[model samples]
Target: MADFVEKASEKITKLSDEQLERLLNTVREENKIYDSIIQSIPSGLVIVDNNWCITKINKSAKRYLHFFHLHLIKSDPVWNLIADEEVSNFISFCAQKQNTNTNEEFSIVSADDKARFIVVSILPLVCDGKIAGTIIFIEDITAKRQQEILMHRMESLKSLTNLAASVAHEIKNPLGAISIHIQLLQKSIKKCREGDGQLPDEKFMEKYLSVVNEEIENLNKIVMDFLFAVRPLKVNMTLSEPDSIIEKSINFFMPEFENCGIEVSVNLQGNRNRLLIDEKLFREIFINIVQNAKAAILSSKKSNGKLAINSFIKNDHYILTIADNGCGMDEATCSRIFEPYYTTKADGTGLGLTTVYKIVKEFRGEITVNSELDEGTVFTVQIPVPQKETMLLEE
Candidate 1:
């Protein structure tokens, strides 16, 4: 290739003035076309030398630079144009590792003091098997990022609306029952006053009162559950043993488990290291899940129902799993198990799993369920190990 270039150079020098002029004109036209292509690109393009000096920039890049209150000057350090220290540092790090391809997204405040999101991609410019510089592609993704955020908020608003509707529906049923019972009681008393001037029969009065009382209790429970599901939890982070909490929660329900003929098996061999969590909320997590499992077992009507709990550590996270050999849920049910006011049981408030989900998320953890109809279900919870403990374990 070197010899060929040398021959070509000699031929170029040997050309007559007229022919050379024609050749130069053609070369200049081709250069103009290349420049036009670069300028026409929508995304910002910048070329920087090995010294981090801006060598060439398209019109789009210049416009972006202007936003940053920078000018397109020859041999200007590219870092000087970046207002974000983190972004500048990242670019420098990437440039140091030649031949590296990097794509990064970050937010910057332009000269107008308006926040903008920018995506940057850097590619190595190679010459003679060595990196001579880098080609940077910058894209202003402020509009796109804002659109995504707006869409997410809209989705959240839609979910909130659905939740409100469910709450109203739940309250309406019990409220309607209470109202009917009250009206009946009023009529009975009015008839007694107008006819015999005597009180209503004890049994009839008791029946109506009991119905009203039960309906009121149901309404209270629904309100409480709704509040618990929506209220921001007050988390008190503590380093506590998960096994102990699990044992306590299970023991609290031992009588019910025995009466329902559901066998409970537990294996707590996970991280011996205490987890950083809220003790009350963490216990609630176990209680809710165990209650859910017990209900599933009862629903299955299994003669030899079994509830199994296990714990282990993997990938710097503590994993707690509960499996029940009970009537399982279908895919649709499983998918919405964590949604507010979603339940399969007649008496279920539908907020048990929702509360569990919120608690797990408070700990920066994750929960997942897998089940098949007529089979069984498994709920897996993963809580990240505390940073200090993880570091100690690694050591």
Candidate 2:
């Protein structure tokens, strides 16, 4: 709190008695009006002393403190009430800031609970150019912040949806045409080789047919990837075994392992393997990732690529990590790896990773990539487990 006497003395000496009395009366009336306004304000307001103790609190501030089991006191620690590092540091710094000059806003949690945002301002009172205590204003803008986040999320979803639709529309026709050409080439080969009395263009025809088949397969993969992104499905949410998903996908990729000279190892943290996931889509997710691991290992030319697949239950989510000691991607390559039609290989479809990304998003899960050039890449997927109600229904 500032010294009212010093503040009064500096200006009072220059005024007559009648003038001073009128000024004092006007000040008192203004204080009453300000108190009324503070009480009616939606957000909390607390004026703290130099030591960060509550000096004066409005009605809203009192209610907020009571809800969070805090009391107004002198010389008490403001940081102690808000046990978040960001908030504590912000207030400690703001307390030293000149209120009239600096205006700072930061997000603060509610008493070591969840992420509750608050915008705090420090306003200083000065007497004759001397430092005085600060006045703190606390406004709860949690709902507004959440609304902004929701809007951003909606926009991202819309953009992704539109991209998927465009890719599907553009790639479907080409894929169909490629399939027709493959069928026609196969028929022609069967007809031309039927009367093989030293076929004239047999060698050239074989080479051309092989190239056509390879390209057709690649185009089909591209089409599937596009369809996976554009197509929406109703998820079957259940407590699924994470390790089983990994094992199944690995077993399915055994042929790839033989071809690529790769070995896979699994480590399950505990018995908890269940997650709320769609069995079919989850299988697709694992296939895409494991296949990627095989490709990376093959491309690197390592004697045997070591792929470590692991899953663990953490918090309210199930986390799965697929790590491969293959030729890892650089930062630039990793950034666009999930984008549709973005491939590094000359003959690659560039849709495998895109499909993996879409499946992860469908489950409301997050997938993060960490990779370095030549070292390897580790992809972490976090998927939320079904709640008890949903789990029971599935059972």
Candidate 3:
């Protein structure tokens, strides 16, 4: 807090010498009042001199920036606290800008997984028509960003629900015919080889058949996964071992992880594995998250990859968190991750995470994601446990 005070209001008439001296003494005693008001303001306030030195900073500014005022003062450049060059350039422009107040919204990720969106309005103070200093007002908008993400998810769920039946009717219904046709073609090829009794370029025929078979199988799997994603929730919720479910899901992707040189660790400590959850639905959720982690690692082009899974009981909920050392995402990608048909992968259908979100919601669970680009990603899930007495009473 600074001892600076704004100019006295001009409500007084022409006063005698004694009256003027009394008013001056009163103002001197109220200097701390201005400091208190500045410190109590919710928005961050920073005042910089013409030389770009941080002359006055309020408490909110220090808290928002996650820095101490002491570290930034003492003739240190103001822009050094902000890592981005673009932000620094804007600050410089704001300080020198004359006769105008500039407003801008930018995001800053601190030393944590969360990103802070801040709106800055820089007002230049002019002294005798010359640029003197700047007053930067900062407001945090992180909650606004989170609200936008929630709205996007609601819209995505509506779209997915409306399209699910039509897609299944148009494509999935013909899958049986497609599979039968592929089998017929295979039999026809076999007969041709048998009739000739002298197969030429047999390796060529085999390779072509292999590629076609693999693609058809891949297509069939994609359709099934999509249908599963759009399927109505009819899970059989019962007492189940959570660790077993985790292990089973990991087993499904074990070969792929090993092939990619990815090491995975699972910690089920304090996780009693006693929960009322649908085993199949749990498997589906784990598969989607684990596979995406693998895809992220592959995209990073790093020498090695790591996947860590930790589960524990917190309060009345079972919490699970998965961390990966892989190609992380920016704020935009992270926000839209749970939306249907929004994917970072070139070959991804983007319904995978959407399905996971749907299942989690059905189970009355909460899920969150944190990522840093080029660093990694982490997903935390907390599923509430129902009381045994309440269930028995219903019966």
lDDT tens readout by residue for model 2, 1-395: 12553476588878889878877777777788878997888877766666777666777654443323256365466755654555466677666552333433344334434455555555664566855566666667667655654564465467766776776676676666666766766676677678673443776566656666666777676677666666665555433566776676777777767776678788877765455466788988887887787778888999968989888888978888989998999999999999877898888888778878877876778999999998899999998764322111110
Residue 255, model 2, lDDT: 77
Best candidate according to lDDT: 1
Q: Rank the candidates by lDDT, best first.
A: 1, 3, 2
Per-candidate total of colliding backbone pairs: 0, 3, 0
Candidate 3 on 269-382: residue-level lDDT in tens?
554545556789988888789888888988998888999999988788888899998999999999999976778888898788888888787666889999999999999888
Q: Which is the winner by lDDT between candidate 1 and candidate 3?
A: 1
Write one digit per residue (lDDT tens) for candidate 1, span 15-90.
8898678666766777788899999998889888888788778887655544243464454567767666756766
Q: Where does candidate 2 have its weakest 10-residue lDDT segment?
A: 386-395
Backbone clashes in model 1: 0
Q: Candidate 1 clashing pairs?
A: none
- Per-candidate TM-scores read 0.46, 0.43, 0.42
Worst 10 residues of 1 by lDDT: 386-395
Question: Once superposed on the true structure, which residue ranges of model 3 sit more than 4 Å away at CA?
Answer: 1-231, 390-395
**Best by the TM-score measure:** 1
Question: What's the lDDT of the predicted structure labeled candidate 1?
Answer: 0.77
Candidate 2, residue 115: Cα displacement in angstroms equals 35
* Stretches > 4 Å off in candidate 2: 1-156, 160-230, 255-259, 389-395
